[model samples]
Structure formats: structure tokens, C-alpha cells
Target: MVIHQNFLPLASSGLPVGKIYLGYLFIRPVHNPETPFKMDVSFIKHWKKRTTLEVGHRGMGNSYTKCAVARENSIHSLNKASERGADYVEFDVQLTKDKIPVIFHDFHVMVSVAKRSPEKDVHQIAVKDLKLDQLRLLHLDHVQHHSNTPLNEQVIKVTGENDEAEDLRPFPTLIEALQNVSTDVGFNVEIKFPMVQEDGINECENYFEHNEFLDRILKDVFLHGGKRRIVFSSFDPDICTMVATKQNKYPVLFLCCGANTRHQVYQDERTRTSLTAVNFAAGCGILGVNFHSEDVLRDHSPITKAKQLGLISFVWGDELNDKTNVEFMKKTVGVDGVIYDRIGETELRSSVFMLEKAKKNELFSKKIPSPVQTPRAGSVHFLNDQPKIPGLNLSQSVNQPHHEWPISSSSRRRSPTVTTEAEKYFAASHGLIQLNQGYLPQQLTTAREV
Candidate 1:
């Protein structure tokens, strides 16, 4: 025995329906299927499986198609990622010559100038070589895909150029960028290091020694903790080691790049496989490895290997960094998190975490399970090939248009004119509104006045 929700206005004559939800009515079949109980579907809708984990790499990520947005490390990108329902945002951080840490991608940045500073124009300049105020004079040049940037903007660019330093892209200090973001999103900061140093004794000279650099950034991160968040990472084992040892429990990740990547090879190499990288990180007390996706497509065996070794895994880059690839990684590859350039693409990934959080919250609540017969009358259950109860499970699906139900020839012939109070009631409801075409609400004049 089952009951319908109060909202449904059942014809109440020939039908033996259990409940009527939006576009759906659960009806008891003339021939019951099991235990003298059976239900028939009145609606068909698409159902989602479960939530996915979404992450933002270097911020919202680059716009692969459009040139409108290209900066992955900029504040605009981070905010865009937040709007896309990302659980966290990832970027890079490095210490400058003056010992100030800033959010940037590479050890060296390209600045374009038509005439000024021609000696070192359009070349990769070490971030430490420039002071904060001087760095602010350049604008971003490689914002995904674009051209030369103005100095006033000071935005970091990633475009390849051969121009002299007349007008260059400006790079931002980490503190300056953090001042403008929200605390809700987590930050994965990877420290950029050069292949080799200039001096032996001053090997730690221009660069803030690992510990000094880590602490200074930590101070800045905590100061903005009320409005921003921070997690540290680096490709250099020493850098991650320095940070993790200082705080024993703060989140830290080890970044792994392919041996032959960046068009160059490291003089002092770490390992051939990223799985070994994660193992190395664990040995150093680092949290986990942020792996490149090329590792996944080539053979995702390392991911499982990392898991077996008891380390958290996060996938990054164009391979597993996109929407489809991330989904595949979670559904097939089974990583704890994913890092990407676009928040929209990663929304599904973040959903995984959201759903888990929601299910956990339900455990603490005192409630009775609903019966399977009616949605509101009982607990929620998934019955195959049937209509769903409205407002029961609000999956985060977009407004996907569906085809209208086709009318059979017999039903079409029997169609009657709308003569019921239903049409009149809608007309009366419209009449109550003081409608306006543009902005202001207008008062309607009576028919007599017209």
C-alpha cells in the first residue's frame, strides 16, 4: 500500500497510481511484479551516476579556443575557477632576489620592449634579478595566446617572443596576487627552481635558502588566510623537503615532470617514472605527487603504484587536465584529485567531493527511512525505467532540452479544445500582474478606460 504526494491532483477514477511527482506518476500495474507490488513509470529522465572531483590548475586554466581569457595564474582565472565550482585552485610560487615570494610559473619571465633595456629584451629573465617595483613595470605577454603586453599591467605572460625590452609583460609578486582572492579555494603552490646555480658559496645567494623562502611565503599566506588559502609544492626535492620539515603537517606536494620535458634535461636527475617521484616524496615526508597526465595515457600503472605505496595522487596537465580526461581518471584511473586549467572542465571532479560531504552530513541526522513506494512518503530509491520525484534529488544538471512526447494518431484525433477553467485560470493569473516590456512595472488601465 502506497500514497501519493499532496501536490498531485490525481483524476482519482480509473488510475491506481501510488504518487504523482512533477511529470511523473507512480502507478500500480494491473499485474503486480513482486510481492503483490508493482509500479509503472509516467516520465523518463536522464540520471547522473555520482559526483566527480574538480580542481583548478594555475587558476581557472587557459582558454584553448578563445583568446578572451588566457592567464591561468592571474586572479581573474582563480575567481573564474571558483565560479565553476572547483574544490581548489593550483599555482606556482617562488622567492625573488629581495626575498619576497610571488605567484609565477617559471624561474625566468619574458619581457618585450621596443627600445628600452634593449640589451636584455624579449628574453627569459630570472625573477630574482628584478625587484618588486621593477617587476611591476611589465605586463603579461603569454596569457595562453596573445601578443606583446604593456609594462603598466605587470602580468606574467607565457608567449614566445624575440622582441627587445621596450614594453614588457609585468609579473606579480605572490603577496600582491593573494591580496585579491578568496579564502574558500585551496592553493597548490609549486616552487620554480633553475637547473643550476651561479655561485658555490652563494649557491643560496640570490635565491632565499629553502627554509627562508618557505617561511616567508607561509607568513604571507597566513596573513591572508582570512581571505585566501595556501599549499606549497615544487619540482625540486629540496624545496618540498624544506617546506614539509618546517611544518610536519601542512599540505605539501611534489611536482613531477618528464625527464626530457621543457626541451632540456636536468643535470642532476631524480627518477625516470613519476611513481618513483611520489615514493621519493613520501620518503621525504611530503604529502603526495602532482603527476603529469602523459604518465596516465602512456600507462596509468604509476597511479595505482602510488596508491599502493600509500600516497595521495593528483593528476595535472592537458592529458588528464581536461573534462573528459579527468572524468576518465576518476572513473577509471581513480586519483584522489585532479589539477586543470579550466574550472568549467573540472566542475564534475569537484562534485565528487561535494557529494561525499553531503552523504557524510546525512549520517549525523536523526531520521526515518522513507518507504520505496512513494518518494516523499518514504526513502529515496532508484527504480529502473521510471519517472523521478521532483525536488527529491536535485542533481546539478544544466537545462538540457529534451524532445516533447509524441502524440499518437488516436490521441491526436481525440484531442479536445481547451474549454476547462484551466485556461481561464492562467489568463486571470496573468491579468493580476502589472506587466512591463522593459524595466519598470506598469499599472494596467481598465478595459473601460482603454
Candidate 2:
């Protein structure tokens, strides 16, 4: 997007109004005494169209974020992500004082000060200084459901079955998240703290009494395991080691960051540059690595080398600063995923994928001369084409998506029905993800039913 600005005065107010030239469109400012505002945006030349990775940032990216949606860790947000075409979602979970594993991100809750001490105003008091119960009464300013509104307002107004759906949102337990997630999408679960003391933060008394919290999370994860892929991550080496050793089924990812970040990783860990932080994770015999994208670019190096070592790489950052960065990571660096702030963005990119998928399905129908079944993007159909149905028009129109698609795929959709001289023909589910469930219109068929 390239933007050019021009200013004009309002006849009513004599204030300078602005008009922005963005490509062919003229954009005007929104209610700010400005005539028109222009923002010229363009992506990096090196980074073009790339596959948009599925991601979940906390729950709903709304007001109360401390994993407090009664169903915050509920299946709703996860299902919402699914609707948005997310391939996977990220969440933070940790242990509570009761040794129960809970899904929460921040270390403290923001509470208003207790009623004035009968003297001076107590408004200056910090929320963290208050006890858990005191904080409980006070609502979070940032609710996952509504952005930065008062939690009390959201709670009073929210209409759901449980408190999780209510406003003062208590954190979701680990069992709660495990039960809620989609079996198909992958999970990027960041363990809130470590099992043992690194220096002082993860001491047994502070974080958990025993490793029972870890055990409980892993147990629930394994017991109800479905098609969902699991990736466990933590800044604590002890926790990383435990996940690697104790859980044999899922993949373990080591999370590393700088001082201001949630957890710290030693500088010695940057051995694999081309492959990025994924190399360090592989070195530890874990599955992958999640690094700050700021570290990815600011380091001024490539991580492709690390990829050769079989390390899965991912970046978390404001990659959306420009869509070009998204292309750079996927096309040039070949990262496994990029987590970001907006879930709606993922949908725009997915539409491109669906369009390409449609084209590929058409190409597939050409090579196989069988039932001539064509499944719609995001849908599946059992077709029995007839003279009444008429053959599909090959050149009706090109299905173009609003967004750009990622790298070209190596595989193509296979024909669902196969008929041969020697073998009998049958049907199978098309391999497209999120296959729709419905029937072709009655006007579409006179052929035999399956």
C-alpha cells in the first residue's frame, strides 16, 4: 500500500482536512476533522505471497486475557479459530496454588484499591499487591471477549451457561483446555513456569508443590488425545527436559527469549542460525522452537541451516507490521508457523488457499475419467452426474480469491471415485481439509445414489 496525502479546509470549520491517495482509491479520515487520510502500504519485495499459518492468541484476543473465560479455555474460542481457518492455536497454561493445572498467562490480576482507608484515596494502590480474593472481586480491564473494557461490565452483560462465559473470568484449568480443543488442529501450549527452580522463580513452594501439575496436564493430554497434534513449550529447561522425557507421544518445543520477555534463554543457545531457534530445540531432542521474530530479523541471519538439521521453526511477533514479513518467513526462511494478533487475517489468506484448491481439483478431474465428481472448496459431495445434471462448464469463470495464496503445493487432489475395466469403482472422502457435509441439490442428479 502506497499512500499520498493532500489537505483541504472544511467550509464549515476552516480546519485543514486530508485526502489520501492509495493506489486507485482515495481514502478519507474518520471523524477527526481531517478531510482524507492516506496510508500507502507495500510488502517487502523479497517476500511475496506465502502461506498464512493458523494461530490463536490467548482466547478471542478480547478483554479478559488471563485465560479467565470460564470457557476461556473452552471449546468456543477453539471452535471460533476453526471457523476462521486456523490450522493451530497458541495458549498459556500453568499450575495453581492447589496444584491444579490451570490455563492462564499473566502472573497477576489488576484489581482496584480497597475502599478508601477512611483517610486518603486508595486509588493509587496496585492490583498485584492485593490478595487473590481481593483481586477476584475486582474485574480485569482487558477481557479476552471484548478488548480493553471493564471486566465487570462484560461479566454483568455476558449470557452463558457458566462463569467461564461470565465476566470476572476465572482461569481455565488444563483439563478444561485439553477437553475443548479441536482434534484436528495442532496445539502450541506454553507451560507457564517450570517444574523445578531455575534460580528462584520456579521453586516448588512458589509454583507447585510437586510435579503433579505437570503430570496432570500430560495425563489429560494423552488420555483424550485425538487427531490434534501437541507441541509443549516452556522457558524453563527443567520443564522442557521433563516434557521430553516424560511425554513420548507429543512434540516438545523450547521457548527462548530476552530479559523483558516472559522467560529467559541463555545466549549460548543460538547455535543454529539458518534454521533459527528450531535448531536449539532439536539439540535438546525436542520437536521444535518458538522464537521472537524480532530476534529472527534483528539477528541479521538466516535459519535455513537449522532446518536442515530437522528442526521445526516458528516466530511470534508483530509480523503483521507488513504482510511482506509473513512471506519472508515462509518463502525464504520456511518457518513452520507465525503467531500474530489478528485471527481474521488468517481467513483472508485461507480463502486464497481454497481458490487454488478448487483449481487443482479441476486439474485432477481431467486426468481421471471416472465419475467426474467435483467437490466445492471447503465442502465434499457424492456426485452421480447425469444427462440431466449436465457436465460442469470447464471455463465458466476463474475462481479468484481476494487474498494471495502461499507457495505452490507439491501434491494435488485425487479423484474421489475411480472406475476401471478390471476393478470396481467406489468412493472415498476427498483429502481437502474442513470438508463440508451436505447434499447436492435435487436438480443436480438423476444418477444412482451411493
Candidate 3:
């Protein structure tokens, strides 16, 4: 499948601090992972480029809304993501009883009240049921009810009163987050709309009408975003459609739970599978689908299908915490972007890839051996599985770069090669190799094998 993208820049150079820009994208039908591949159908047209964008999930990091220092979705957490050089700081935005949008994660948060009698009563209150002032006066020290931990164990509040400890602050309004976060960093606004009941019962109460909810938030973003790059997303297909149709100022991304989505109470038919999301987003003229990592890794046909339809693709899940999983997403699955918890660590690992590229470049400049010349740009190759190493195969080359030579743990043998300055550095760095003039380094010999 041929995948392409036209990057619609949010602003000339930097984010418009109080404004948002939305663009259009298309998606094609994705088949099962095990299905045979087929040609892609024509979709939308714009520009065609492939680049990986990084988004920080719920600020720099979160342990299920319990970040180590800053409260998840708080202003402090958002700022930390920006400081760590994330292209976008993603957070959940929900409404209060007064129709105000606040940066919060869960639908129902535990509320605690301590009275003069030293007796405290706790209740699991839906965020939409409380006025902004009432919500503000109550500290956000409780966990989501889905945590399964007892209510008593969930109320551990940040007790210190330091400026950096802004986790102690009450939940922040959407306007506050927009006004305070850095102008250069973008925002991935995940709108938290409640789901429907399985038995056809109305699951939510005291909530603003869908149109009103969308309108209020759009007005706030227009007034405060100031050309900021805003990518609106939601789990609800209807909400995604509303955002896509209501305005053209920002892109809409459909967030899918996919096959391995855990702890879900109810499932919407439109978003039951990644394939459904691909079709739904395309029909709605939405830009992309942010799938869970399990969905993509299990069967990357969706990524291919999305690309064929001229749609942008993104992945987010706990699996992204491992750098290996992240590399696989970028190198093998070929996603447009990934949202992970450890933004700093992921970015650092990405830099290591750059370092490897630099090393390859240095080797090429020094006229390294023929078996391992720098593979063409945007091309990835793997070492042949044969017992004997074979030279490069120009015919097998593809657009993905770096034909990797993995040292298999089961293989205790080494391939011999002529030594150069690059080999000398490799030997010195690993301390397993001994370099000699015009001779293969010890690191390249069998002596270093386990």
C-alpha cells in the first residue's frame, strides 16, 4: 500500500498562542491483519510526506492520572511536557456543571469533605454535576472509581505548599491551560464525552447538549489558542463528527480502543474495532485515527490502509513505555506519530537512532567495507538469516533506512571485516574489541562471543 501525507502547518513557524488551525485528511478501508495485501483505493489529495510526530500523553507522564510529582492533566504537568520538548502535550478536557471546560481525565472523581467534627465523607461525583466554584473549592485528591482500590486508599493529597508542587492546586480550566502553556508547544485536546449504556439507558445526566458543549469549547479555543496547533480528538464517533463538521479550524482525530482495550464498561458500535474507526473517520472527513498500540502491533494493515487513503495515523498505549515497542512502531509499523507516557525517554531513544545514523554516516565518509555500506535514505534492511553473511542486496532495498545487523544471542560466531577508524572507535567504546592496523578488530572476531 502506498501511504502519503501533506503536512498542514498550524502556523508560519510557532504555535499561535490563542488560535487553532485545522486541516483535512482521508482514510481507506483497513482489513484484518492476517488478510492478504491488496492495492490501495484513491482517497483525498494534498501533499505526501512521512514524518513521525511525538505527543506527550497526559502531560510528560502519568501513572493512570497519578503522576509522580504533578497531578495528571494539571497545568503543572502540561508545562513540564512543554519544557521537555514534546511537540504536543495531550490532555483530557471535560465539562463542569456550569458548562466550563476543565483539564481533567476521569468522568467521575472522588470528592472528600472534612468537617469540624473530624469526620470525612467521600462521594464519587460526576464532574458535570458540580459547579466550577464547588469543584474548585474541593481538592482533586481522589482516584477514578475504576481503579478498584478502596475509597479510603485513594485520597492521598499532595500536602506540600511549594510553587513547583502545583499538583496541590485545584483542577485547571481549559482556558488556564491554553493561557499558560508555552507558545511553541502544541495541544492534543482529547474531549471526554460520556458513553451510552448497553441496555439503552441514558448513562449521563446534567450534561450540556452536545452542540452547546462543542460550541463553548470552540469559543474558548478561538479566543485563547492564538494560532496554536490544536488537534481535537475523542473516543465518541459522534463527538468526532461534531468537531469535524462544526468547524474547520482544527483537525479531528478519532481515538479507538481497538481489540485489547481493557476495563471498558461499554462499547460503541462505530468504534468497536480499528477498521470501523478507519471507515468512520473517512466518511466523516476526519483527519486521522489514533489507535491503541496493541491494535497496530498485532496487525499493521490498518497503518497501510490509512496511508493508502491519505490519512494520518497515530498510536497510543502502555506498550509505548518500552523503547523497543516505540522503535517497532516507527520502523516497522510506519505510523505518523505516537503518544507515550515517558515523553523524555522516548525522545532520548529517538536521539539514539539519530546517533546510529550519524555513526553510519561517519563510516561511509571513511570508506567502510562493502558488505555494510550506508543503505539508501529511508530504507531499512535486516541481516540475512543464513549461517554465512552475504553482501548487500540492492534489489531487496526499500524506502525505510538502516539495514540492521543484529547480534543474535544464539549465534556465537562473528563475521570478519577489515578494520578502519570507525571499527577502532567501536572497539574502544565496547571494550570487547582490540584494533590492529589493517586487521579485523577483536570485537569483530569470535573471541568476544558468549
Candidate 4:
């Protein structure tokens, strides 16, 4: 649990040990009543039921590389993902020069400026340097690389200067997304913060102060995120810590590149590997770790370690685009969620939470017969004539007739009745069930007991 002294300067400061001081402003940890020490696992309760969530990456897909329906992080992209039945939609959020939280991915954006020649001169500008109005007035392109790398062939043209539709435009405000997107779909809000790369280059020079930066974003979310299932994540461990301390309504996940060969690793020690990220997350008392697909594909033991620690495991990266890899993570590797591009393109799937809700409603609507009491001593009773409900796991009594519940093929493949320690922890914490106790037949009869 050692924090680098350089990351947090506390020398000669009169503030508390965990409190961070930036100039004259003191940042103190705020306790959330909902989740005092850990994140509220109720958001992803279905994960324990073997329902691996499908989160749309940057909405429908990353527009720069993938063939997405709309610009990445745009309002249209998020709404499309919701319509496609994605359980959750992940998007990057950073602050504009005006301190407005806006959805965008890269730290730098390529702004097309008019020149004397026919072709417009493109300039790479840091997103934080531009005001919201100024950013909305520029034709922006995704910056792939600084060393003359060609722009992506599939890049969605973001014409913020023209009279384009609001939904199709890039840099949609955070408040706008909270209001317009479907409430059924959860949000995996990745807080965008600049960091040092493995090559000793800073992602963005002279970015906003961490404390002030997080404050503004948290303010927006707190004010606008009404009853929405939200989870905050960040590659910067400090940002994750700040977010976890700032609010209790939503959970915080540490985003780790892990052991990836596709991109240069970050300089942060906490993000060097999935194992280290897990240790950091466990030590920080956060919810879980979002490991890159490369690391998990290389060695899935980290996910096992995460599960053992009762932490939620989520995988993200370009490797998730392959259907086989997605299946491997979902079935073989056993991750809680997968963040990928073009969700529902390979095979259409509904949100696991939504499906579970429907199943609960259907199960409760029918009258479940109570177990018949037997007058004979030392003998088990059987409900041989009771009709079994689909997708419901009925308790089996000794010497009773074995009845198999009819379940769809897809349901059997995706979800199993087997429970995990993480699920037990959630069920106990949320008062859904008593720890180390099996569900009785009567418990299944009520929605609250279940």
C-alpha cells in the first residue's frame, strides 16, 4: 500500500495523512453511506449468476478503427448501443477548457484548419486546451500517432463546424448523455486523465489539476446521474482513488493495460500488470480491475486471483473483437464483463440484468406451490405434481422426484446456477441472502427474498 511520495506531496503539510493538498485547496476524503468501504455490487449482481455482461466500447464501437454507426463517444453512438441491448456502454470523459465534462477518447485531437492550399492543414491540439464552444466549432479527427502515422481509414468524419445533427457530433457533454441515453443501460464512465507512457513521454503536458479536475466531473455526475447504474473507472490510480472517495452512489474500477504488447505500457507501477493492478485495487478497497485483453489472453490467472479476492473482473482491448476470444473470456476464462466494439453484431444479446428482471417477474406471477408437509417421521416429502418454472432452480429434497426446469439453449450456455464467493459477498452485503445458507423453497416465492 505504498504510494509514491512524488504522486502525493504531504511534507510539512498540516492536513490529514490521506488528504491531498494542491496549492491552497485541501482535498479530503468523503465517505459515501451507500458503500462505505467497497462499491455497491448490486449493480452487477447477475455476474455471480454466470451472466457475463457485454459492454459496448465507446458506444456501438470505436469509430477510429471499427466500423461504428456513429462517431465514438457521440450521443448517437451511446443510444445505438442501448438500442442494441448492450448491458453497459463504456465511454471516456475528460474536462474541456471551460471545465465542462465531455466525452472523447484521446488526449489529443486533430483539428483541420484551412490553409492557402486546397488541402486543409491539420493541427494536433490537446483537448484540454480548447473551450467547449471552440471545440464545437472545429472539424476534429482522431489522432492515431504523433509520428506521421496516417489517419485511420474508417475514421468517422466529425464536422462540429457544420450544421450537423446534435447526436451525430463528437464531444457530447456528460450531462447531455446522462439525460438522453436509455436509463435501462448502465454506464461505464472511464475518467480520462493524462499519464506518462513507457517511452518517457507524458500523454498531455500541463493538464488540469487532478483535484479540481475530478471535482468538476463528480459534480456533473452527482447533479445529473439520477438512479442510473454508473461505474467510474480510470487508468490513473489516483483518479480512481479520488473517484472512490468522492462518491458512494457509483462504484470505481481500476483500468489496467496489464501485460499488453500492442501498446507501450504505462509508467505507473500500479498498472504494470494485471496482478499488480489487482493488488492495488484490493489494497485501495475499490470494486475491481479492468484488465486489457492482451494480459488476460496471455495469462488468465490474474482473473482467477481477482475472483478469489471477491473482486469483479472485466476485460477490454482490441483482442475482444474476435468472437472466439469473447467466448473464451465469458465461458472459459470466466470474466464478469467484456468491453468490446460493435456489440450485438456477431450475435444479438439482451442485457443480462434486463433478462433476469423479466424472468423474476414471470416466476413471481405464477403461484408456486408450497412443499407438502408429510406426517410420516424421518421421511422426505415430494411435490411430484407441481409444475416447474422455466429458468428457476428449485430446491431438491431427499427422495423427491427430480424435476428439470426447462431453459432456453442460450440461457443454459450463458448462465449456470453455480454461485461464487463474489456472489455470496454481494448477496450478504445487499441483504439478499444470509451468508453460508441455502435458499429455501419459501425464499424463492418472494422477489425480496430472492
Q: Per-residue CA lDDT of candidate 4, range 35-65, in tens? A: 5556444343223445788999999998775
Query: Among all windows of ten consecutive residues in candidate 2, which has the lowest summed lDDT?
Result: 8-17
lDDT of each: 0.53, 0.47, 0.65, 0.75
Worst 10 residues of 4 by lDDT: 377-386
| TM per candidate | 0.55, 0.52, 0.63, 0.71
Error of 2 at 62 (Å): 6.9
Q: Give the Cα error of residue 291 in candidate 1, in Å.
A: 1.4
Question: Per-residue alpha-carbon lDDT of model 3 for 1-450, expressed as tens digits?
Answer: 333442122212231211232532222222212222432422222223436767788886774554444566777777776676677789998888888998777777666777777667777778899888877666655555456777866775522243444443556898988888876677889998777534443345546666667777877886788866788899877677667655555788899887764636334666677887788778767888999898788888877888788788889988887889888998888887789885775344332223445788898789645685543322222222333336642234422232334343445423224245554444343333333322222323465572
Higher-scoring candidate on TM-score, 1 or 3: 3
Best by TM-score: 4
Model 3 alpha-carbon drift over 4 Å, by segment: 1-50, 63-69, 115-119, 158-170, 197-203, 346-450
Per-residue lDDT for 39 in model 2? 21
TM-score pick, better of 2 and 3: 3
> Which stretch of 10 consecutive residues in model 1 shows the poorest summed lDDT?
376-385
Pull out the clashing pairs in model 4.
Answer: none
Evaluate residue 444 in candidate 4 and report its C-alpha lDDT on the 0 to 100 scale.
Answer: 50
Which lDDT tens digits does candidate 2 get at residues 334-426? 777776554654335443344566788898878755695555542323222212224332133223211111222324332222223211111
